[model samples]
Target: METITFHSYRGGVGKTVLSVNTAVQLALLGKKVCLVDFDLRAPSHQSLFISSTFSMSPTAKSFTGFLVGDHEPQSVINSTDKENFYCVFSDIEIFQQKESKVRTKLTQHGEGRILAKLFEFVRYCNTQKFDFLIFDCMPGVTYRSLDALIVSDKIMVVTRPVKSEISGLRLVISECYSKLEGAEIFSIMNQVENIKDLVHPPNPLDVNFAKVNVLGITKCLEESSVPIPLLHSFPRVPFVTERIYVLDEKNHPFTVEIETFCNKLLQK
Candidate 1:
C-alpha cells in the first residue's frame, strides 16, 4: 500500500474535495483505494456522500472508535458504492474530547504508545492489499495531522492562490519539507481562476524553500449558497431528491478538471 496524505495550512482550500474525488478516480482506474478522513477535529468526509435525508453510520462506530480501541481498525473500514473504494471517517464525538491525550500519546516519546497502536493500524492496511491509501489530514499544524504526515509516503500540500494562504504555505514548506530529508512534497494549487495563472510559479520566492514538484492546479467550481467545492455538489435530479448522487457529469467543467488532475497525479 502506498500512502498519500492531503494536508493544508488552513481549511477551505478544497482539500477534502480534491482528496475524495481523486480517490474515486483512482478506484475507477482499478486501483483498490481507501480514503481516510483523518481530520479528527471536524470530520466531514461523510458530507461527500450525505444529503438532507441520508446519513451514514455514526462516527462513534467509525475510525475514531479504532483510535480509542472502541472497535477494531478493520471494523471501522466502510465500503462506498464504488467498487474497490472505501472510507474511514474520524469520530467527531470521541476525537474532539480525546484529541489532546491522543496527540500527547502519539508525539511524547517519538513513536510512543499511541503511534505504536496506529502503526498496527497501518500494518493492517498494508495487509489489505490496497494499491493507494489516501488520507484527508486535518488542516493546520496539529500534532495528529503531523503524525499522519510522518507516516505517509507522499505529502500533497493543498493550498490556494490567496496572499494569506501563500504566506502560510511558505511556512509549511520551509518547516516541513525544506530540511526534511526523506519525504517528497507535492504542491497542488486550488481555486485558481485560469490554467494560465499556474504557469507562473506560485510564491516564486519560496520555490527553493518548498522543494515540491507542482502536481496540478484546478479551477474553483463554487456557488454562493454552498460555499464549498462544487465537485461534490449535487442538485435534485429527476429520480433522486435528497441524496447526493455520484458525480457522472463527464462533460462538466469541474469534472473535466478533476479527471485531468487525477491523470496528472498518476503520471507523476
Candidate 2:
C-alpha cells in the first residue's frame, strides 16, 4: 500500500480538510483508503467525522492507544459506512492531560518506539490490502511529525500565501524536509487567490494584493533547499467552512477542486 502524509508548516492552512476529502474521494473511486489522524496535540478528525454525515463504527482504540502499546493496529482502525473507507482518530484528551501516560509515550524519549509503532500500523494496512494509507499529520517539525515524514511514501506539504507562512515554510524545508530521504516530496499551494473566480465585492485593489501574495508564496516554494514539485493548487472557496464537501456537495467548487486533486494524486 502507498502511504501518503498531509502536513503543513503551521496550522489554519486547511491541511485536515484537504486530507479528509482526499481520502473520501479516493474511497468513492473504489479504492481502499485508511486515514489516520496523527495530529495528537490538537486532534480534529474525531469531531469532523462525528459531525459529518459519514458513518463510522465505534472504535475501540485511538491512534494514541496504538502508539502506547495499549491496542493492536486492527483494533484502532474504525470502518466507515462508505465501503473501502476507514479511519483511526487521535485522542485529544490524552494530549491535553498533563499527567496522561499516553502523552508521555509520544512526547518523551520514545520517538524510536513511536516510529516503530507507526511502521507496524503501516504493515497492518498493507496486510489488509489497502490501496492507500493517508496520515493527517501535526504541523511543524516535531519528533512525531518526523515519524510521519519518515514513514511516508509521499509527503504533501500544504502551505498558504501569507508572509508568516512563507518564512515558516522556508524554515521547515531547510531544517526538516531537506534532511529527509527516500520519499517523494510535493507542495500544495492552498487557499490561493483565484482572481479568475472571484465573486465578491470585485475590488481591483484586493485583486492586486492577492496577486502579489500568490507570487511570493510561489517564489518561496521554487527557491526551497530540496526540489519539491508543485502537486496542485486549491482555490479559496469563499464562506465554505471545512466539511466533507466531496460527500456533502459533489458539485461544489471546493469539491470539484478536491476531485481534480485526487485524480491527479492517483496518477502519482
Candidate 3:
C-alpha cells in the first residue's frame, strides 16, 4: 500500500483539513483508501467524518487500546459512512500514557514496539486491498509523529505564510530528513490570501515562507512549480466551515478541490 503522510511543524495550519480533503478526493476517484488519524493527542478526523455524531470513546477497542496492547489493531478500524474512507480514532488519554512509556524505552533501545504495531496495521490494510493509506499526523516532531514519518512513503509538510510557522517547517524538514533518510518530501502553503502581491507583503512574517515551494488559490494547479504540485487551495471560503463537517461532496469547495486533486494523483 502507498502511504502519504500530512504533517506540520505547528498546529492549526490546516493539516487535518488538507489530509481529510485529500483522502476524500482520492476516494471519489474510485481508489480504495484508508485515512488513519495518527494525531493521538487531539483526534478530530472522526468528528469530521461523522459530523460530531460520535465521540471518541476511550475504550479498550479504540486506537489508544490498540497502541497499548489492550486490544487488537483490527478492532480499532471504524468505517465512516463515507465510501472508501475508513477511520481509526485516537484516545488522547491512553495515547499520552502509551507515548510516555514508548518514549522512555526508545531512549535506551533506539527502538520501540509501537513502530512494529504500526507496520502490522499497514500490513493488515495491504491485505484488505487498500490502494492508498493516508496518515493525518499530529503537529510537532514527537516520537509518535516520527513513527508516522518513518513509515510514510511520501511526506507532505503543511504550513501557513508566517515566519514562525515557516521556521517550524525548516525544523520539521531537518527532523524528517534525519530520520527518513531519502523519503520524498513536499510542501503545501495553506491559508494563502494572495500569491501575486506576496512579493512584498505588510507582514514580515509572511516573507519567511517565501523560499519554499508554495501553492495558492490564485495559481492554476497545472502551472504549479512544486514537485507533486498542490492538488488545490481552498481560497478562504466561508462555506469551508460548514462543508468540512459534512460528507456531501457537492457543496464543499475543499471537497471539489480534493476531487480535482485526486484526479491528479490518479494521473501520477
**Backbone Cα, N, C clashes tallied per candidate:** 0, 0, 0
lDDT of 2: 0.89
Candidate 1 lDDT, 145-251, residue by residue in tens: 76777777777777765556655765665555454455556766665544233556566555433332222112221211112121222111223221222255556
Give lDDT tens digits, candidate 3, residues 1-268.
7888888888888888888767766766677888887887788865665564433342225665676567776688876555676677776554456557643543232466777777888888889899998889888878778888888887787767555664565566556544575456666667665545344545655543443334222232233333334444444444455234324556565666566656665665
Off by over 4 Å in 1: 52-60, 95-111, 195-246
Q: Candidate 2: misplaced stretches above 4 Å?
A: 196-203
lDDT of 2 by residue, 3-47 (tens): 999999998898899999999999999999999999999988888
Among all candidates shown, the one with the greatest TM-score: 2
Cα lDDT of all candidates, in order?
Answer: 0.64, 0.89, 0.65
Worst 10 residues of 2 by lDDT: 193-202
By lDDT, the better pick of 1 and 2 is 2
* lDDT leaderboard ranking: 2, 3, 1
Off by over 4 Å in 3: 52-60, 95-110, 194-234, 242-246, 249-251
- Quote the positional error of residue 41 for candidate 2 in Å: 1.0
Error of 2 at 211 (Å): 1.8
